[model samples]
Target chain A: SQTIHQWPATLVQPVGSPLSLECTVEGTSNPNLYWYRQAAGRGLQLLFYSVGIGQISSEVPQNLSASRPQDRQFILSSKKLLLSDSGFYLCAWISGGNTEAFFGQGTRLTVV
Target chain B: AQSVSQHNHHVILSEAASLELGCNYSYGGTVNLFWYVQYPGQHLQLLLKYFSGDPLVKGIKGFEAEFIKSKFSFNLRKPSVQWSDTAEYFCAVELYGGSQGNLIFGKGTKLSVKP
Candidate 1:
């Protein structure tokens, strides 16, 4: 079985502070990784997705960026946080040729 | 741009009542469809999926959905809903043969079933 782990279940960050949220998947290789953000009472917005290591496609141009350093490790980062950046961030993984995506426990980020 | 639409933002129903949730997508091509459920304070889980073959797909917990390609709709249904069925349901779509498995999600429908 594959499992996804996301760190810092909740975080409080000051404006203009750097941010890093990590997500790692175990028991799967070369899986498709995605980063999504959900505002309160709103639908999920896809931020970034990667097909392979060092390859990322950004959906919405924002302050956030995503990187897949290894086959199972994905990181979402921002140089400076904005008040609008506060939301629920989720990491998901889907094996190649599979349409169902498995999501990790999301991180609730609050930028004050 | 592809987008998904869920008709109801929130619904309240009594136990044993029939349930129907509408979902529509704007994309003209081969696509994969899915319905995910999120319980209170829980991660999203797949309720059912429609990749190909049968148009009517049955999922866990007696939930079923029919894929009507002509209408670009996939409506979820249940003959009888229980109080435990209270949850947020999300409809998602992914373009087939696309390079990435990017799923476009609809504004989820929050279902509250009364015992």
Candidate 2:
């Protein structure tokens, strides 16, 4: 069975501080990885998605960027965080021939 | 541009009451439909999905949804909802044969079931 691990279940970062949230999947290869932000009343917003290593597609223009360093390791980073950047971030993956997505326990980031 | 619409922003129902959440999408081509659930303080989990074949699909926890192609709607239903079913439900759509990476989601409907 495949599992996704997202770190820092809860984070409190000062404004303008650098940020890095990591997500990695086990038991799967070449899986599609995605980063999503969940906000109050806004539902889930797709921030970035990668189909392979070093390849990322941004859905919204904001203070966040994503990278796929390895086949199953994805990283979301920001040089300087903004107050608006605080939200529940989720990592999800879908393997070949599978349309159903599996999600990891999200990171609740609070930028104060 | 592709978009998804979830009709009910919030719904309040008593235990054992019937439930129905409406979902519709804007896309001309073949597409895939999905329903996800998020309990309090938990990760989003897949409730059900519709790719093809049966228009009606059964999901976990006695949840089911029907896909109506003509109306572009995938409505979720439960015969009798429990208090434990209190959670937010999301409707998502993916363009079939298009970019598999982009899974457009709706704003979501929050369901509150009173015991």
What does chain B score (TM) in every candidate?
A: 0.98, 0.98
Report per-candidate DockQ: 0.79, 0.71
lDDT of 1 by residue, B1-115 (tens): 8899999999999999999999999999999999999999999999999999999999999999999999999999999999999999999999887757789999899999999
Model 1 lDDT, full chain set = 0.93
Deviation (Å) of B47 in candidate 1: 0.4
Reproduced native contacts, each prediction: 0.71, 0.69
Residue pairs clashing, model 1:
none
Q: What does TM-score give for chain A of every model? A: 0.96, 0.98
**Which residues of candidate 2, in runs, are more than 4 Å off?**
none
Using DockQ as the measure, the top candidate is: 1
